[model samples]
Every structure is written in C-alpha cells, then in structure tokens.
Target: IIQGYGLTESSGSVASTVGPEESKAYGSVGKLASHLQAKIVDPSTGEALGPGQRGELWVRGPLVMKGYVGDDKATAETVDSEGWLKTGDLCYFNEDGFLYIVDRLKELIKYKGYQVPPAELEHILQSHPEIADAAVIGYPDEDAGQLPMAFIVRQPGSNLTRQQVIDYVAKHVAPYKKVRRVAFVNAIPKSPAGKILRRELVQQALSMGASKL
Candidate 1:
C-alpha cells in the first residue's frame, strides 16, 4: 500500500499507503514515505518504544504540518516544543519492521490492570467459522473499567447462534480477552471507507446487555 503520515495540528495522515500490495498488509498502516519520520513511543511515560512493543505512534519531518490555527493549548498538548507530533494511535512494529495498528490510546481497555485490546477480539471473531464480519468495542464496567463486547454478522444461511459465537471466542482467547456479550446483526455498520463504527456498536451492545442471546 502507498503510505503517508501527518499530524493533528498540520492535518491528518501526512503520508498515505498506496499501491495494491501495500494495502493488503492488514497488520500495519504501511511504510513511511521519504518526507516523514515515524516513531513508536511508550504511552505510559512518553519514552520512545522499540520495534515490536506496543505504544503510541509519533511523527516529524517534511510532511509534518505547521501548527495550530487558533488553539495554542490544544496544539501544545499534541505537538511538543521540539515539533514532534504526539499521535494518539496505539500500535507496534512487526519483526519485519512494518507497523501494526492495535487500537487508539484512549480506547484501550484496562481489565483489572490488564490491558485488553478490542481489535484482537474482532480478529478472533472474524476468524470464526460462521462469522462473516465482527466488531468489538469496550463498554464501561463498574469494576473492570471497561469490558469487551462483540457484534457480529453471520454468514448467509449459517446456523450459528449468539451463544455459539461467544463460546467459540471464549474457548480460543484468554479469559480477559473473551467477548462478554454478543449481538448478531444483519450487517456490521461501517464507514464509507469500511472502518467499523465502534460508537454505534457500543450503543447496540449496551441495549442488548440484559439479553441472553
């Protein structure tokens, strides 16, 4: 895929991934272009994280934007004095050095101090035998802070049921990563570019919280 990088103050996505082969690397956003410099930083302390470690993605270089149009505080929070843009994205680099997007920094769920990634559950759901598509979102919880919930679209004419989907993911993933709730819909709502609309799915999960199936 052709790749691009950008900053919040300058603009979104300064560099973009292009070409057929580059776009197929679903694990990562893509390689950096000549004009950009990207770094993965430790979210906990703002330290630069090494390859293969989960952290926030940061960028600088030519493709970087100028600065805030009006809001200095907002600009300051995102861009440091040295001009490095603090991207709120959560991701890691593969062994081959391609970037792998995991989740947003704020969307990461803390389950009793253990971080639970919603995207991982979605991947597991998509792998299920009867699921055509799936979306997982974090829901507020009294104790865990946030819990993993799933929404799925079954394969056409497939006989799988809600409990079956839940059991399937539960059996394969760690308990903390298991789908606590499941909802089967006619289709998985998505953006025009094909990203799952997590906000809507989270609302649907809340509405179906009391239902067994």
Candidate 2:
C-alpha cells in the first residue's frame, strides 16, 4: 500500500513510497525526500536514537512550516533553534530506512513511572470481535501516578463484559500494560481525518469520575 507522512504544518508529504520496489515494504511511510532530513530522538533527553529504536520523530526541511502565525510561544515550542520541527509523533526506522509511525508521544500513558503506549492497548482492543473501536488514556492515580483507562465501542449486538476486556488485554500484554479502567460508549469522538480526540475523552473520563474497571 502507498503510504506517506505529512502534516498541514509541513505543507504536504515530505516522505512517501517511491516505486514498485519500495512499495513492497510493509508498514512503512517510505524514505524521506532528498531535501528533507529526519531523525528519531529520545523525547525526554533529546538524544538521537538508532534505527529500530522508537522515539519522537523530528524533521527539518524546506517543506517544514516557518512558524505559527502570530503565535510565537507555540512556534518556539514546536520548532527548535536548529530549525528541526518536533513532530510529536513516535516512530522508528527499519534497517532498510523505511519509517514506521508508532503513536503520539504526548498520548503515552504513565503507569507507576513506566510509559505505556495507549495505541498498543487500543490496537489489541480493536482486534476483539466484540469491540468495534477503542481509545486509551491515562487517568490520574495517586499511587501509580496514572492508570491506563480504555473507552470502548462495542460491536453491534456484542455483549462484551468489563472483565473480559481486562482479561483479554492482560493475556496479551505485560502486567503493567493491562487496561485497569474501562468505559463503554456509543461512539468514539474523532477528527475529520479520523484521529482519535483523546483530549476530549480524557476530559469526559474526568467528568464522569472515572473509576476502576
């Protein structure tokens, strides 16, 4: 499948599948264009990571946006002094240099100081025949710092139970990654581009006094 990575801020795609030979690689956004430079860096330390090491993706190229209009603070936060735009996306490159997007760095769930990627749980939840869609967020917990919580949309006529949801994830992931809280909803809020509106769900969970699963 043809795939590319781009954002409105970048004007358009800076990387895409080049040809039939490159299109054979699965789960990649293809190689970067000649004029563009990209790197995967440790989000906390800014240290560059090697291929196959997942980290925050950064890009610097003519295609990158100059700055946000009339928003110096936002611009400063996004574009570093070296002109590299912090994409906020977690990704890694394969040995063949194909880029693979993971999940958003900001959306990672922290449980007992361990970082848990919400997308990993969401993916597993969606794989269940009884679940149509899912979104995962970290809810504040005094002890664990944050607890992984899931907002699920069940398949039509499916009678999935909360225990089943917890058990399913528990069996698939490490003990720390199991979803501890769950809320079933009619639908998951998403953007026009189909991106999960995680912030909205986080707020909704808080307003509903989100509790244990």
Candidate 3:
C-alpha cells in the first residue's frame, strides 16, 4: 500500500507514493502530484529551505481552494496572497524528493532554543514493553522555555516508573528532547479518530500546578 498527504483545503491528495520503486522510501508520502508546486519553508524565518531540511510544506496549484467560505480571516492566515497554502505540518523532503512528515507545526515543544517534535518522544515512550500508550506535551518552564513532558499509560499490571520513562526516551533522543517529567495516567485523552487531545493534557497539567510527576 502507498501513503499520501493532503487536506480538505487542497481539494484532495497533493502527494503520494506512486509505483513500487518510490514506495521503497518507506515513511515518505512520495513526490508532489502533477500541476502542484511545493516548497519547504522555515516557519520562523520564512526562508525557503532545500532538500532534507525540516520545515513547513507549502503548496500551490489549481487544485487548491480559492479561500475558506465566509472565513476571510482564517483564509488569509492559511493561504498567502501569492497563493501558497501553509500546510501547518512540519515535514522535510529527502534528496530523492520524497516527503517525510515529522509532526504538527503547532505541537512542537520549544525547549531552550531547540524545536523538539513531541511525536518523536511519544514514539520512543510507546516503544517500551511496559508502555501501553503515551502522549508528549510542552510543559511550562521559566529557564528552558518548555520541557518535554510525557503522559503515559502503562501496560496491564506493569509498574513503570517516571524515571524509567525518562531514561528510555533519553537513550533514544538528544539531550534537549529528553522527557523531563512523566505522569502515569489510566488513559491518554484522545479524539474519536485517535488523535491525542494534547490541549486537555496541557490544561490538566496547568491545573495540577506541579512540575514533578
């Protein structure tokens, strides 16, 4: 099976892994579709990035919508005057032009000066044998700006500790991306479609008013 990427605003698929050869790229969603022009842009600097650089994927094409109906403000923020639609997804193109989605642009954890993708940490946390599910969020911190915090659900009868979760993620990621705090939850809040309801967790964390797990 092939993977693809697009949104309702794009009028359907913008990129897809076509044949067997391109499908070999594994995690990539393939190259841009015909009549579609795409560019990777640095979200912070708005500078166009080259291949292998992780940034927001912007696309322009006939297939793209004119604007959101009755929502000019939202339309203006999403689609630029020049017609490039900011996909709001953090992605990168490989040397072969295959697109690799990292995570949602807004969901990134800002730790110190580095941008850490929470999905990366969540993936590591969920990989542990004792972990049933996991979600990562940007916890508030004065000095670090934000620290990577994990809300984890342990496997049945498992007794995983917060430090164990931290160490597991630390081993798989850089020092900046380490899980600084962990909370063992019965279940992670999620949408009906299985997307993590991170805002809820963030609010819960704030309500708790404690940094320690």
TM-score for all models, in order of appearance: 0.82, 0.92, 0.95
Predicted candidate 1 versus true structure: per-residue lDDT over 1-213, tens digit per residue: 355545454455644557887777775667665566778998788898888899988878764665777988878888788778877888777676577778877777777777888778888888977889888777778888777777788899898877788788888888888777677789888999798788887777777766543
Return the number of clashes found in candidate 2. Answer: 0
Query: Which predicted model would earn the best TM-score?
Result: 3
User: Candidate 2's residue-wise lDDT over 1-213, tens digit each?
Assistant: 788888877778867898888998887889987788999999889999999999998999987999999999999999999899999998999988899888888888889988899999998999999999999999889999999999999999999998899999999999999999999999999999899998899889888884434
Residue pairs clashing, model 2:
none
Residue 188, model 1: lDDT of 86
Candidate 2 residue runs with Cα over 4 Å from true position: 210-213
Query: Which candidate tops lDDT?
Result: 3
Ranking by lDDT: 3, 2, 1
List, residue by residue over 1-213, the lDDT tens digit for candidate 3.
Answer: 799999999999989999899989998898889989999999989999999999999999998998998999999999999999999999999898889999999999999999999998888887899999999999999999998999999999998898888888889888888999888889999999899999999998888777456
lDDT of 2 at 155: 94
What's the CA RMSD for each of the models? 3.1, 1.7, 1.3
